[model samples]
Target chain A: MSENKRTEVDQLGEFGLIERITKDVEINHKSTVKGIGDDAAVIDCGDDYMVVSTDMLLEGIHFDLSFMPLQHLGYKAIAVNVSDIAAMNALPEQVTVSIAITNRFSVEAIDMIYQGIKAACKNYNVDLVGGDTTSSRSGLVISVSVTGRVAKDKIVYRSGAKKGDILCLSGDIGGAYMGLQVLLREKKVYESNPEMQPKLDDYEYIVGRQLRPEARTDVIHDLREIGIVPTSMIDVSDGVASEIMHICKASGVGAAIYEQKLPVDQRTFDACHEFKIPSVTPGLNGGEDYELLFTIDQEDFKKVEKNPNIYFIGYIDEAESGARMVTVGDQIVPISAQGFKHF
Target chain B: MSENKRTEVDQLGEFGLIERITKDVEINHKSTVKGIGDDAAVIDCGDDYMVVSTDMLLEGIHFDLSFMPLQHLGYKAIAVNVSDIAAMNALPEQVTVSIAITNRFSVEAIDMIYQGIKAACKNYNVDLVGGDTTSSRSGLVISVSVTGRVAKDKIVYRSGAKKGDILCLSGDIGGAYMGLQVLLREKKVYESNPEMQPKLDDYEYIVGRQLRPEARTDVIHDLREIGIVPTSMIDVSDGVASEIMHICKASGVGAAIYEQKLPVDQRTFDACHEFKIPSVTPGLNGGEDYELLFTIDQEDFKKVEKNPNIYFIGYIDEAESGARMVTVGDQIVPISAQGFKHF
Candidate 1:
């Protein structure tokens, strides 16, 4: 009721706000094996552990509907949540989607969205178990919650990394971010001149990376096939730098990544050049990649060393060293998280 | 992209729309015991069954901040989701809450919401394990997903009722609906005259019903103590009439509720009279009661016949009879579901 002191949400940031909210929460249920802070919460089932995670996407902040097809939007919603489950080394079994839209959207529009949702459901082999659909006063809001399962011995967390573990990435980074830039530029051009046809053919790969991202469950399957379990794992949602910092803080270890080892597709690199931005900047700080950033034991590195899809980027180190990156010119600099600022 | 045939969502209604969306879904997991068309999705958890449900609430549609305090709003959101778990005769173990808010909210305001959420977590014995926090372009949106567990034999669904079963009510109904009316009236008064303070003391009982309704977990415990497993069950979220119709349709039976047997709080009855609305209207169609409506075999009725909180309001009949209500004047009227129209 008092207006004397009002602190903006941006001041605390997303993580800061989450920490404040979870600080006082007490776990009363014995079945809750893990709570808060992890990619997903782990619950004790009879034969295995259940992993649950949820994410909320808002219009304007998370996506621009102007250039985004409803079908891709629906598919991306499921993929993002599934990526969280994949981060825990778990197989997602079910997902619940809740969407709020205004009357401006027609029933046909909703069907297109579901067409994409059903496609993702089949692709990931996860059932559309339950959801809630309601009306919103303004823009669209999509919230998805997914549940997954993993063997008790195979469950992984962000706190499992060791000092000598090898850090690896599932796929290339920054393509999604570069794709967004291209789309925004094209949108501006189309808005300024109605007759201008958007030139997007050359940027197809990057645009597809942004419009439709995959969860990397295949990579999880590959690791299982090779008899390797990630020591620590996290989804590369908020870029490699921010995710690395999270792994470091949770595992109580530092990391040193090499700039040259970072994976950036050729198309993404060219787009970066055209946009007048450094490729490494987008690779390190661009969010929404939905790739997996994980660390495996050094002894198991030989098993996946030759894998084409997996790239070795860094190694875990003592906590005192902090998280840093070595430049191409032999300069060492501390990594700062400049991820997406929703506020 | 053709605008020739745009169908309004309100035409299909919420249930119709859900049916349209879920009609083509294919269940791909053996662990999924039940999907959609239930209070929650039931999944096989080896020794037991896990039930999952999700609900979304938006500002201006679900609640108005003018009369609905943020603390109570947070508490109600969790309670409503937990009620769905209770509907399936399960014990909730964990919940994930995802919220999106605009910059208009302050740190203190967020803390208040979390305080209420934590309080509900303690009361329900459920853990706040995971959640997502992000910025919204407009009003606040809260989406809560809850997972609960029940013994495989005790898991109840809406499709298990049989002819000659007795219909039972967990507690008083129509209070929450009347409560909303009182709040809306008081809100309008305050809006017209800014200096007018809301006179809510006399209507505290009903107003609290709207703002802080509790899930009927107590009733579930009572049923368990008496060795009773409801043949069919549902939460009284969308009024008694809508829920009964759901049970009849799912179970392939008919039900006849007695108007005189409907339970109403004295305060709610008095308020309804003052508002010049029939008491039966809110009792039969008023929603958000969060009470459990269930059916039991007539042979098992004696076990809970004397329970104080349980009221016997109706009986199951042959499907050909159709769902109806017997008025106090000895007239029978068919029931229609004019439930909450969020669209």
Candidate 2:
């Protein structure tokens, strides 16, 4: 720590910080097929390639308990990590969940959280393996790491796409972001008027998206069954824009996504309109979607072209072209990431 | 969740809490051979078994950053998780670390912590495969999970011990606890007078023991090399007394540990004496020893009898006899566990 070299994390942003931090990391093990720059790290474990990914959720920083139920919070933690494994086109086999809670939580409260965790495990067919439960000085903290397995040939990474690949997205986006908007608005309303009930009935779909987002494991299975191999893949965690940028930088190819092709749910668009937020903004940069963003060879495009669930939104191009979006007015514009900032 | 049946975690203690929490857990995956009740969960990955263990370190709850360096905290976090794998008689191959830090932490501070993590991974020959870094609302929190592998025949569990098995403890104990006392004392002295240079030179070994403890993986390697298998094993993260109780309960046996045979470092003994704490109490009840406690077949005792690092402290007996200890003064006392309570 030199006195003159204090680098603020904000100046570098999350991606920049990760780049600086992982720059010197060396993979010494023969089994470690991949280290960073992927949805999950890949390890060659004899018969199968093990995929490992981790996620940490912090109170206040990541979620507000006033809007987030403990059970949903627990499920979301597991889902997010599982989503990472799904991005690698792997089947999640085991997960470890570590939580730190303050004394304000009772034994029953903890059990409620575990109940959701157990439910998620059963739903995803993953075994809850090992973890640490400890006391926290302040708020709740949950960190979950999941391990999955895939055949060596089936594994996908963020750095495998080439120029002329088609960018595909699994399912819709912006619902979770819109759901967060509704929750925050309701919270503010409730805070001001203690007697009022949150009007969540009308926004159930979007709210559900925020509270209980499922990992795109189904899409991974579908891809496998359809015999489609993703050239490059990542989860839409930070946002479509940021994640596409990640794919572009890692795969050394630019992408041109069409804004008109973006799949924003009806409820999501209505919620955005109701909240006075730009309709396209939520789909483009609002995060926590957990959808799969992948690139496929142009030859295999026809296989998924008619699939209702799969949306073709972009095409890979030369690196010098940069990541951009083709708008409805037939104008091409550069895509700049405005993902959630914690700092 | 019934209102009439509120179970407090403190009443159950840590192990009791664990048992209560995991009692109803159902393993849904055929790959998951073992979920809980061991140092690491075992998943049958076709040709080999993958063992996973997780550990969490919280600020104030786990350690005081005033005297503990970020690097040592990082090192200890990895070492503790590795110790769990060693307890399973497995070799750690990969690790995922998740960290939450407030903006108060500079990139340099985070780098120091990662430096320690990197050093530990290098020392243990494990790959730093994946991790998550996020902003924390309060203090720094680090959670690490390691995956290891062991032969099916050689994997040790806590329920495998038989009556008359010789109990062995690796290396010395109580040094970490004594080191903590010294650090606390220095902190108090520094608090009282800002300009005072609190003495720490003489207590280097004990203080180092508290700040940075190594896992007893060497003992595991030695035992494997000697073709001696521990019937039951656990890491002494809690006090030796508490861990022995766990082994006895799991194995359905009684233990007779001799007080005179307990291993204690000279510096630890001196520190205990200086602090006017019972010398035997520190050796038996002090936590963070990071030593391996195991029971071996009596036939295998001769192989380790000449080993300097291994100390034969007791023997297993029938369950009806209960866990008891023979004092140096020739008094037979029933064993009591006053384990470290993180809550």
Candidate 3:
């Protein structure tokens, strides 16, 4: 606005631009318990707290329609927002989905997308509440906002971890990232030779991970059942390394995760080998995993110690140490974030 | 999905498509008081009801940056969503804005948008909560989700009006639409003659109406203060005729509105005359006016009778009468809906 000064968005990156934009915001309501820092915004609604989270998924930038099924895209849009609510250890109750689409889509095609949305809502036990449907000039864009509830005492934030806390991850990582790789590869092959069918039979597991990643609402429920609220929580959206950095930065503590303890599915490793990617690179930096990466206090660690689904791979340390990974070769290397780079 | 059968979206139109999509939607949560078909979804949160609404605005469809300042675009985006909250007679508490921008946008350009967002939040007494920032493949896209609270007894729906109820309209109409016409004319003129500056001085009022329309939150507040709640209410987003049809269809009644009673600003009339638009046509079907249309009981009419801001436009009648408009020449004509046709 000031004459001819132009600073490209990528120069600041997504996180930096967000910080710069929201710096001068002022909260005006007493019900707003939390604003723009956590996975979801927290609002105090008297008896319980309501947590709200939103996500916007655009075609091309977030998905390639050639390989990403419309149904899966719709389901993933809902799941992505639900995952944010799960990160706060909350129960999602309602969601609003707004979609903008080009006229290239037919009613049946849109219905297929809604079928997936309905399936996801039923799976997550959340009601589809309200939304806006409009015309778009380009590719499809789906934005979902979810509202959930948590008891006053059971809320978890990303800034609650302390020194000596245990870092935990749910299930395995890199499958979704590798799944995208497989899809992209198959797409390129199909483009060159239309006669060649996609060789997705052997890559079903990884492909499924990419097409329909589920939110960790089940883990949130399991944690509540175990009566152990995580000290800090975040979803592994941008892989393990970036998630570790977020936990470290938010809690003002450092973490040391062991590469040897990192969980990997056989199918994921196979896809990684096929793609010729480094052993730990996809596991550390590959994104869209949607797995929960949380920290639990040492005293409560015994509760989840025997849980097979939760993988304990690290410990929180002093802030000065920073975030680092202990490799299988017994080397300590600082973890770097290769977070969302859509800009 | 059914073999070769393809139903084009435009065949159903926007409203028909919405009805088709939400027809079989199942509400899975008791907390979901009301879902689609209203201004905002109502969720029961303890003693009061929490209302949520979402809107997606694309560059070419909802706005054009050439004439629409980024700051006003940001302001209008939030205002549009907030208007839905006001339509439900709720006080907005917080809002989350998700934006997708291309690299063509500078940090300063984005900051201008946020500055307007922050300004609107301050003006509307709402807090800036959470949002997503991502790179758009094409033009800018802004999706905003707003959450507001209304007392259980104070929550009004479009289906509450009864026969004999007085239809009330807030302020005026058609200014925003006329303002848009003026701007578009100016844009065309500028396109042909680049050196000619836009002649927007005389049309400032109508131009502002188009660029930055305000939601009728004041009327909601005044109604609350007066201890009078309308039986039903809706906002004029897709023309007053469409809103009348919606209220009639939902309430299962009819109405006879008077064209002589329709309120119009002086500048709006001037612009309408300049554009050669027929009298009363713009008032009936001009969209994006963001004014409240409600029906009040005759017993409570005296409460708002002295209020100059409130205009008595019509009265509810028997269901068989349908919705008709009484012309200034004393002719009766059916009010037809020219609603959102984005598809």
Tell me, by lDDT, which candidate is best: 1
lDDT of 1 by residue, A1-343 (tens): 6746788887998888988899888887888999999999999988999999999888988988999999999999999999999999999999998999899988888988899898999999999999999999999988999999999999999999989999999999999999999998999999999899999999999999999999999988998999999999999999999999999999999999999999999999999999999999989999889999999999999999999999999999999999999999989999998885532
Most DockQ-accurate candidate: 3
Q: Give a tens-digit lDDT track for model 2, residues A1-343.
A: 4755887888887777777778888788787899877889988777789898998889998888898888898899899999999999999999988888887777888888898898899889898887888888999988898989899899999999899999999979999888888898899999999899999999999999989999999998999999998999999988899899989989998999998999999999899888899878889888889999999999998898889999999899999999999999989999887775531
Individual DockQ of the candidates? 0.82, 0.69, 0.89
* Cα DockQ of the candidate 3 complex: 0.89
Question: Using DockQ as the measure, what is the rank order of every candidate, best first?
Answer: 3, 1, 2
Interface RMSD per candidate:
1.1, 1.6, 0.8
Tens digit per residue, CA lDDT, model 1, B147-235: 99999999999999999999999999999999999888888899999899999999999999999999988888888989999999999
For B1-343, candidate 2 gives per-residue lDDT tens digits of 5755766666666667677678887887787889877889998866778889998899989989888898999999999999999999988988988888888888888899999999999999888888888888789999998988888889899988889999999989889888888888989999999798869999999898889999888887898999988999999988899889889998999999999999998999999999999888878888998999999999998898999999989999999888888999989989888887542
TM-score of each: 0.98, 0.97, 0.98
DockQ preference between candidates 2 and 3, better one: 3
Off by over 4 Å in 2: B1-8
TM-score of chain B of 1: 0.98
Worst 10 residues of 2 chain A by lDDT: A334-343
